[model samples]
Target: AQSVTQPDIHITVSEGASLELRCNYSYGATPYLFWYVQSPGQGLQLLLKYFSGDTLVQGIKGFEAEFKRSQSSFNLRKPSVHWSDAAEYFCAVGARASGGSYIPTFGRGTSLIVHP
Candidate 1:
């Protein structure tokens, strides 16, 4: 079975500060990892993903992530935080089911709080 874990439930950062949200996963094989952000009442928007190729992938909104197979981690980072960046972040792992379908399992999520 594959699972994603986000140890931090909530994180507070001062505006304009760098931010890093941690994510770890356990899967039988190489998994498709993703980072998504959700606004208060909006649907989730994918930030980035990793399937293969370069370990570091650039994403929208000045965000990027590095896929570390050794550590089973895909942590999201932002060079500078903004007030509008306050939202819920989720780490998900996608695995192929027996039916040949891609099933995504999401982490509990980490809330970002930006302080002025």
Candidate 2:
């Protein structure tokens, strides 16, 4: 079984400061990793993903993540944070099923709080 873990429950950062959200996963095989953001009372939006090829992948909203096979981690990073970036970020790991469908296992999520 595969699982995702987000150690930080909450993080507060200055409005213009850089941000890094941690994500770790456990899986027997090569896992499909994803990062998603969710505004309050809104649905989750896909930020980035790593299926194969490049270990470093670019994401929307100035976000980027590097997949480290040695550490089994996919940490998200933003050069600068904004007020609008305040939201909940989730890390998920997906496993392929018999039908080739991906089954996602989501982490609890890290809440980003932006301050002036």
Candidate 3:
């Protein structure tokens, strides 16, 4: 069974500062990576996803992630974070199952705090 690990439970960054959230996955074969953000009282919004092709993939809201096979990591980054970006970020890893559907494993989640 594969699992996802988000090292940081909470991360604080000043508004307009660069932000990076760490995500590591344990899987034998190639896996899928997904980043999602959930604001207060809002549904989870997909920030980015990496299935294949590019190692560095751009996402919505000026976010991007790089998939490093050697490191078994898919880290999400934003050059300048906004105060509205404060939310709970989740890292998920999916693998193809016998039925050709993907089974996703999610990390506990990392809370982002924005400072003035």
Candidate 4:
């Protein structure tokens, strides 16, 4: 069985400040990892994905994440966050059942609050 857990339910940061969101997953084999941002009332947009190779992956909107195999974690980071980035962020892992077939599973989501 594969499962993802995001410790934070919400976060607040000032505009232009750095941001980091935590994520943890449980799986037997290395699974696909992804970060998605969803604006109010909108669907999720892929920020980045770690399928294979390169533990450190860059994503859209100047976001990046580093995969730690031993820790069973993939955490998202941004140097400077914009107000537009103040939305809900979800950390997910692609899980498969018995075979190669996989489905996307998301965390509870962290609501980002950008203080003006």
Candidate 5:
């Protein structure tokens, strides 16, 4: 089974400062990674994903991720964070289950605290 871990439980960043959230995965084959953000009482929104191709992939909301096969890491980064960006971020790994259905194993999640 593939699993992902977000080491930080809570990350605090000043408004307009750069931010990076760490994610590491354990899987036998090529892994599918995703970053999701959840605001209070809101559903998780896809921030980015990495399946194949270029190591650097861009996504909405000025976010990007780099897939590092050697290190088993797909870290999410943003040049500058806004106060509205404060939310819970999750790192998930996707794999096919026995029934040929795709499933995602998510991390514990990292809560972002933005300071003005």
Candidate 6:
């Protein structure tokens, strides 16, 4: 199955601290990588994506990730934390399947707890 997995279900980060959320994917030929953030049950906002070129990709809201083909991993990182950043983060894989559009397979999700 073309899927993505996020091992961490929950993470707590202090305000103004650093943050890193891990992500791994199972896909052939280096699928599109994306990191999305959602507030509770709300819609997901695309944080970043790695489609073709650059191994190191930057995204909105001061986030960046590196695609490591050898390790089959794309990890999301942020230099500093904000209380508003507290939300559920999901790693996804976008792929074409049998004439259907390339859609994302989301992770179970990691809930970020920002402590003030």
Q: Best candidate, TM-score-wise?
A: 2
Tell me model 5's lDDT, rounded to 2 decimals.
Answer: 0.94
TM-score for model 6? 0.94
Per-residue C-alpha lDDT of model 6 across residues 1-116, encoded as one tens digit per residue: 68888999999999999999999999986688999999976999999999999899999999999999888899999999999999999999998767866878998999999999
Between the candidate structures 1 and 4, which one is better when assessed by TM-score? 1
> Candidate 4, residues 1-116: lDDT per residue as tens digits?
78899999989999999999999998888789999999988999999999999999999989999999999999999999999999999998998756767787889999999998
lDDT of each: 0.97, 0.96, 0.95, 0.93, 0.94, 0.92
- Residue 48 displacement (Å), model 1: 0.4
* Model 3 lDDT, full chain set: 0.95
* Cα lDDT, model 3, residue 87: 99
Could you give the candidate ranking by lDDT, starting with the highest? 1, 2, 3, 5, 4, 6
Q: TM-score of each candidate?
A: 0.96, 0.98, 0.96, 0.94, 0.95, 0.94
Error of 3 at 40 (Å): 1.7
User: Model 1, 19-82: lDDT tens per residue?
Assistant: 9999999999988999999999999999999989999999999999999999999999999999
TM-score of 5: 0.95
- Candidate 6: the clashing residue pairs are none
Candidates ranked by TM-score: 2, 1, 3, 5, 4, 6
| Higher-scoring candidate on TM-score, 2 or 4 | 2
Greater TM-score among 4 and 6 belongs to: 4
Instruction: Write candidate 2's Cα lDDT for 5-114 as tens digits.
Output: 99999999999899999999999998999999999999999999999999999999999999999999999999999999999999999999889799889999999999
Segments in model 6 whose C-alpha atoms lie over 4 Å from true places? 98-100
Model 5 per-residue lDDT tens digits across residues 1-116: 79898999999999999999999999888888899999999999999988899999999999999999999999999999999999999999999778876688999999999999
Q: Which ten residues in a row have the lowest lDDT in candidate 5?
A: 95-104
For candidate 2, the TM-score is 0.98
